[model samples]
Target: MAKLFLLLFTLLNSSFLFSQENTLGNEYCQIQLISTEKSPSVNPPIKNLDKEQVTLLEIPAGKSRLRLNCRLDEQGVFTFGNDEILDVSWEALEVKLVPLAASSPSFLLPTGTFSIDFVFLTHHNYKQNFVWEPIVTFLNASLLNNITMGVFYGLCLTLILYVFFMGRVVGDTRFQFYSLYVFCAATFFLLQEGQLNIFLQQQSFLLSHQFYLLFAGFTVFTAIVFIVRLTDLNTTWPKLTRYGLEFGAVVVLLMSVLMLFLNHNELSALLGSAMARVTLLLMLGILTLVSIQAYRNVQSAKLVLLSLVLMVIAMVFRTVLHDVNPFLQRYSLIIAFAVEAFMLAVAVSERIKSIQTDKILAESQANTDALCNVLNRRGWDKKVNEILSEQKIKGGVICLLYIDLDNFKQINDKWGHDTGDKVLKVVSDIIRNQLRSIDSIGRVGGDEFVALGIFYDRTEAENLVIRIQKRLQAVSLHIDKQKTVEVSASVGHVIYEEPPKGAEVMLSQADQSMYQIKRASKQG
Candidate 1:
């Protein structure tokens, strides 16, 4: 009986020691990670783990999954830092958390020589802090990052909407392309910064990553197009701009297709980043060349060049120090983009203003007579119609004067065409000087001119015509040192207090009356 009691007591003591050794409590613990690549399940047994192949790691206070070879018999809160309770899975031995606050929750674990595996979903430097410090720091950084990105996106959205509306209003293709580029770049930054994942409930990291690449590709493509169009590269550097835009199109298509098949793996991420960098370099090179070529002649191109230079510098800095400063790496591009958008907006405005000015100048040139710098026949007709319409409405008298230079062909044949041209110019100057500023005068044909004047009565019209006829007759052209030639004009007038059938009828009546005066003058 004594031996049996001793044996039972020894067995119970040994069981208690074994249980104590297997239990894990609320303390800092190191874990071993095993890649279960060949295992049928992630929860492989400890017996399958090779001690030499396992890597030891400390647990972090963020979302992570782990496979442990031990089991938890008691339910306890698994805390990472302060008050945050991480989602723990005993069956799979996984903990997922986003440590928003500072607190570490205790976990009671049954210990054994178990295979454990951990995967962190958030990026953090493990050696920076031991407990909740890292989590707090990361959360703070993330908050700041989100705030900065949100403000940037808001500004970009405003610029995008403004440019889109302006593009429609101005009917400029360059504005449309620039707006598209801004939108794509804004979306790319949002995805790259994970803003979409936070705001859009349905968005995943993988989807955002894929879309980041897609918009990045489109942004480059559209930027190339915008530059080409804005600088008039098709006219300035035709072959190079054509080929560059074509290549950009192909790259865009290739990247878009690649996005469809991307799985968001490390290799894909690396390749996408490399492609983006290469595209950026290409764009910078092209823009630099274009800017240099156009800076002297194109004011808008200078602004565009400045914008590109700023963006390229920012991009190069980000690329160089991306691993060093997380905040700059993530947000520098957005800052650069904001500044560039402002500069580009100014460029677009200036370009539109230039276009409007040129259009007005072209219309003026189209309406003016080249020789006498007065209204041409087309302009005269337009003015006469306006006067007739005004007379009909306001009950005013308007007189149409049709004047022809007498024996003009004889003057041209005897004294030469140069003398005849001088005589016509002198006659135009006399008519212009005699008429009121409100009157319209035009050289309708060779040696034939018409004037429209407002008057109070028919006597006033007759007096004005007689004055113009006497002034034109007084004109003389010096053909050479030895001789001078004189010229005279036959004038006819028509007065209307009501709207005529049309300008054509008034013009025809004036022409017949002028021919009658010419015939009487010849007979006399």
Candidate 2:
């Protein structure tokens, strides 16, 4: 009984203090008129900055009972200037203070009771304190809300566009996935920040709360999945990352459903807020580590780091300063999230480029002959055209050669094609060993071969041919009857200032020259 009495006494004292603070004994205007411009990106009335005076309410001096003074700054923020701390330059103004009562009385001062229509009468209970009111039309609340929503819309759109462009350019699966996830997150954030649920024609408490619960839950889950994929964490720490993601998803999903059934509204709200903060912190830690690891080793890892930094900054503004100024707080998060999305998109693009490079290398190796480890005919043709196109600007000369084994058929008929193949392999090896790195060789036919090189003069080209022939002679062969088999080549060469109109033209020229060499050797 004593404890209950003490608690009651304490409550009474607190109530007394609150009542004293809210008292309005003598009817005097304690006016707090605020005039501020909508920050940006919305449908807002253009504030006439030049208008230094505000005609709040017109009334005859003799009929006015109370007065309060205020002034507008350059940015249009109004400050109370009736007190001693008069920071703003006050402009003399008249205003009407109407009462909402039926009794009317007259006095020396403008003290006659006036009547006005009463609107919403909000009351705050002691236990559940209400800090804000539903905006009144007289306060330009709609305009401010519109401006705030507009900024979020523009920011989200920008982020989506950036993510798409970066994903396309990078061509990486992870980056594309990152872009997609960011786009979804931005869309969800835009909806939540805009408070659009309040404006729905058929708004219901259940539907509104459910939408927010699902949207937030899915956003958190999606962000986690995207980060894991983007950082290749699943590959690096497959077991842990995979299990954690799955566990988190399941927990959030269950909580989402539970919130719908919960009787404790405040408890549900607190839990949701706590979970959101925890998820955000965990994501930040994981992303930070991944980004740092990437930056330490990979050339393209900076994009991830940049994205992480941007996200952290955005969350700071959103989680920390949400109540300061709706415009600044909201825009800061929007811009930061958009920037982070762009960076992640860049990271994804780099991954795509790496994949493409690997593909090209694999293709090149595939088209090469394993025996000689040189390009086969197909490879040669592809590389030659590509090289030609690349060097066209430099305007260089090229020498093409066709070399045929003089008695290659006889060797194969006497000894098997296996021996012949060995001989061909040896010859290909020796030719390759003697040629410069810039030169290319291809086995175009059974006994015919093609060589390509950039040359300054015919002397240099002929010298290369002589070197190949000498090396071929030095290479020994094994036959059934003899320890050695003689091998020689009939060589033909052609020079082109530019690539031939057709490959056939170059081949014909080289073939004719090879026949001429054969005839000359026969005559000798």
Candidate 3:
């Protein structure tokens, strides 16, 4: 009976040694046993094994399983260790942590000191000799870390969705895919880091892992898509790297399922990490190459090159560090997202600007007469109404002038239309040279022209019309050798202080006065 009590005491003591109030509270000796192997000690040599409290159990050589774990403290001291009894072979080690306390609603385990042996795996042959210890687990993170990651997740998702939705209307495929890729990368990091578990009532085994894998795959795919698009790689490199990315995507998709179901997590993780690094490098390198080519290849790609430079710098800092402070991580994604989104926005804006410019150019061309470079008759009529509408409310005088060239068709009949065209051009240039920038001129008849000007006074308006007629009369044209013709114009004008009697009324008043003067000149 006494011996039995002693054995019980021993059992309690052993349990006490392994258990603690909190792993975090006992920071000095916090150890996580991730994996173990029961095999021959001399199979594959292990490195960085601390020689204390580590037990070895053996089964055979080169057949041991690897167990891995991470230990952390408030001081930010983090260390990873494995408890495979034998040396590790080249057989890869994969560790998948469920962290039930993080995902389970009723996850209250204990509030006091305790310890539990976390056994990852054992040799298939050594199952009978030793029982695997249950895992030690806890869920403790600084509120700041949790909140930082949470905010980042929300912000990134928002920006991504905004871009995609905007892109739908804007018809920019590059923005659409870029947003998708950024969303995938942001969400995957959140899930993998266990930052998004707060929202889930209960974590679905398949959903958690599978969704993570899906996002990771999509992130890689979208990155490749962006590279191909940004570089126009099909026309540029167009070689093995392009084909390899396509093939890699397929392989990654298939293996992601297998990795989840078959518990080939190590293989999956290693490949995933490797693929991530490779994708980042390839994308950045391709972008750099494209930027160099852009300098010489196209002048418009300068912005594209600048944007790529920013992305390359951001990615290099992101991937190299094993762990980043939560605040920095959150900040990094925000800044990077802003930069990328801004770049895309600029590209979209440039396209919109170009379209608007083209419309303006077309409208200008449509309003102009090709031969005289004056407003077309229809354009002048339209503009007159627009100006009158404004002047009606604002209270201003609009001056209209009618001018007829004397014997102009006789010159066309005698000198040929080519020279007649030259004379017309010369006359149009003279009229344009005499008017204020505010005045508008139009050719309203075969050899007649009309001028419209807005003025605050009738005196300035009359002076402008007289100056124009005098300028035209002084014009001299050489019709042929020793046959130079002196040209003169009959001018008539009217000013409307209020709304016009009618557009046709004002026009006819000016026209009839000009014809009367021409008739008087011919009779004289």
Q: Any residue pairs clashing in model 2, and if so which? A: 170-349, 175-348
> By descending lDDT, how would the candidates be arranged?
1, 3, 2
**Ten-residue segment with the worst summed lDDT in candidate 3?**
77-86
Best by TM-score: 1
Candidate 2 deviant stretches above 4 angstroms: 1-172, 195-209, 253-274, 295-302, 321-328, 367-374, 381-401, 404-448, 451-488, 492-524
Candidate 2: C-alpha lDDT: 0.56
Candidate no. 3 TM-score: 0.58
Q: What's the number of clashes in each of the models?
A: 7, 2, 18
What would the per-residue lDDT of candidate 1 be over residues 388-496, giving only the tens digit for each residue? 8788777668898899988899988987888778777777888899998988899889989999987777788778888887877556656556658777889887887
> Which of the numbered candidates is closest to the native, going by highest lDDT?
1
In model 2, what lDDT does residue 316 have?
69
TM-score of 2: 0.50
Candidates' TM-scores?
A: 0.68, 0.50, 0.58
Error of 3 at 522 (Å): 3.9
